[model samples]
Target: MVYHVLNGDALVSGFKATGLSGEIIVARECLIEGDLKGETLPEFLENRARFVEDEFNEARVHYYNNVVPEFEKLLNAEPGSEFNLWFGYDLFCRANMWFVLSLLSHLEGDKEVNVVYPSFRDKHDIWLEFGRATSEQLQEAFDNRINFAGRDFRLAEDLWTAYKQTDLGRLHDLSIFHSPCFPYLPEVCQAHIDRFPYKGKKGRPERVIEDILKKNGRDFKTVFREFSAREGIYGFGDDQVRKIYDKVMKERNP
Candidate 1:
């Protein structure tokens, strides 16, 4: 039994097209950029569920009842079963990977877990790359999955635990420790830290958006499109971007 887990639903089809046999699970929730104060699974889920519903105005009952249970199945995989994680190198995927790796770290399970990342590309959005990949390419990627050693696990635990904390400084400090577990981690962690508002004023990304709008006189939609094109590495979707735009508008009008 090989369980292939991916970052989101975007690449599920590509994995399935590989004709791999076993269950496929999507992380469903975004742990990369949100409030993570809960100490337990239930508390964490509830916290994220409420945040998503309030921020995105979407319910999480289906996620809690359905998608979460699927993820939990990885915790109980058979002795010989392999748990393959397919993720990208962004903070978004890194956060979820950290959570999953952390969860597996505590469990005394016999299942073999491997990390399969987008090794083919050094700077492209791996999720989008997977979405556009052919079936043969997906299978090749699966065949080339990398197995983690002791140092990787130690680094993973460090990163995962640090990511769940309220102190972004811990993550910023971790940038100095270069490890093979996450080659892009140092830079990505810095990007995450940069996301916080400057002295509780405008966020760096939001300020950049406002500056673009001011100089070009473009509408919000155009500004957002331009931002995505230039700054997609921040892993922010239009909805999150829109909130910042709204904040800027309120600040300007208020």
Candidate 2:
């Protein structure tokens, strides 16, 4: 899929081929600029190369884990339908590549606002799912999906808020609920809190149970008792509860 960009209402070359070509050009430019220097140029190029290498690693992961899986699922279901499937698939690949480029552009510290052109023709999928969502339910879904895939929390949070006005409460609730499997989920909530972007600073939970109770509006003691009473549930003794309590308190205090 060819991804185009609109600059001042004029359509430009898409990122899949053009944008990558641009990156290579920039790298060459950097090398030329570095050549003018005596000692610092090598260090500068080394740092730039490291940054590019890191971005490439991240892009590969995002492609394999997020982009490819979605395309594979669609391909498996459809088999040999060639009308829009291939086009859409190619576009999605470009979009994912564009997303990586977007991050790289930021790291490169370019003054011009470089818009990352997605390979996909339609921007709906790019924004609706790949970008951040505004609705509470969709935001939660996106958060959970990111956590399950073990993506960068900051990136997930940025994507969550880019396209919509999200309620911080909804994000907090979702993060806490999904924290066990998604250990880094707490970082997104923390980032939100650090910005003071919303009202009502309900105290964060110290432990998993406390977090669940606070987020879900449940009584932790009652829930624990019920679970303990259930057969084969309380494999650990009361010491486990004490340990959990201690850990929760420590986190809260710390």
Candidate 3:
């Protein structure tokens, strides 16, 4: 059997439109992209779900329930089975992709793993972005998927551990050993590091938002929409953007 694993439910509809016959698992958890720490995947997910429940309450119950069962299939892959990963170029998608790669390295089976990412031309193209692509474009990406090499898996394993620890330095050091395996790793890692509050001057991305709000006097929603369209690398959703805005406002006004 073949499986097309996507980052989230956003792309599931588009993927289904392709009429592909296989299991489509939408990874609901953002794993490394969020503040989750655990020695094992289950522990990590449990912590993340709990973290979400602290804020969202029961709204995430259905999602939390699906995380484990959907993940188990990848954890225990059978021989002759293929797992195709479809993720984007941003920190959110790349971090999740690394998690899957890290897990696959430990699986004791002859499973085939492939990855489909935004091509060079599609890097900034809205059409090829996750949940934005048409069925035909998704099929094109699936048709031209790349096989994960040994180095790619090793890089992912190491990066996954570093990311979980929030060790940006380790990621920076790893960038020295550049390889085609993760051409987008350094940039994404850098984006993740920059998410932290800067010591001097305004924090990078939040600073951008602050400038827009201060200068243009736009509402938070407009600032978020414009900022996302401009930067596009961090892939911050509305909630994340709002969180940053709150932090920036607190620091500035207080």
Candidate 4:
């Protein structure tokens, strides 16, 4: 059976429009913004569940009902099943991809996993080009999925291990592998590292946002546009960027 593991619900319609006969499983949780510590799998889920509740102001029930089931799909898949992971090249998508690959690495099976990248791409704004792609274009991407060799999975495993351990240095070193299947991995890893608090005790993205706001005044629409144009690699939507803006201004004015 073919299982399509998507990055999020945003790509569901485009994927379903392809008329592909497969189970659509979405990775509902965001791993990029939470603590990555736990001795066991269940404990890890609980920690993430709590983090999601606090960070998103969501309830634990939502995590159990919405998030856990999707991961369960990955865990319970039958042996020899075909898995196609549809994730973007941004840090957010790459984090989830790393987790999925880490899980798949442990699963005992004849797992033939492939990464279905964006088919219709934009060189300038490549991170978001797939979001505006047509359904036919998405299908084209699926049809030309990139299969992983043994070494690719091993590389994914190492990268994920480093991420889980919060080993930024290891992640940077591992990113140098330059896997054929994941050309943007080095940039993604650096983007992840860049997310940590840096200059002026702010994340590089946050610093850029603050600078944009300061230059353009409090007009959020203009600030967001500048941010997107300047740091498209972050792949931050308005809502996410707005959260940062709200916090920065709160601290600045108050």
Clashes of each: 0, 4, 0, 0
Candidate lDDT (C-alpha), each? 0.74, 0.31, 0.75, 0.85
Least accurate stretch of 10 residues (summed lDDT) in model 2?
Answer: 25-34
User: Stretches of candidate 1 above 4 Å error?
Assistant: 122-129, 199-201
TM per prediction: 0.87, 0.19, 0.89, 0.93
* Candidate scoring better on TM-score of 2 and 3: 3
lDDT of 4 by residue, 46-82 (tens): 9998988888799989999998999888889999998
Residue pair clashes in candidate 4: none
lDDT per residue as tens, model 3, 158-225: 88888888888898887666766566667777877777776775557877888878776657878887
How well is each residue in 31-113 modelled by candidate 1, as lDDT tens digits?
Answer: 86667888787798788888877777878886677567866876776666777888777667788888888777665756577
Q: Is candidate 1 or candidate 3 better by lDDT?
A: 3
What's the CA error at residue 139 for candidate 2, in Å? 30
Better of 3 and 4 by lDDT: 4
Q: Which candidate order results from sorting by TM-score in descending order? A: 4, 3, 1, 2
Off by over 4 Å in 2: 1-163, 179-181, 197-254
Indicate the worst ten consecutive residues by lDDT in candidate 1. 122-131
How high is the lDDT of residue 97 in model 1?
Answer: 85
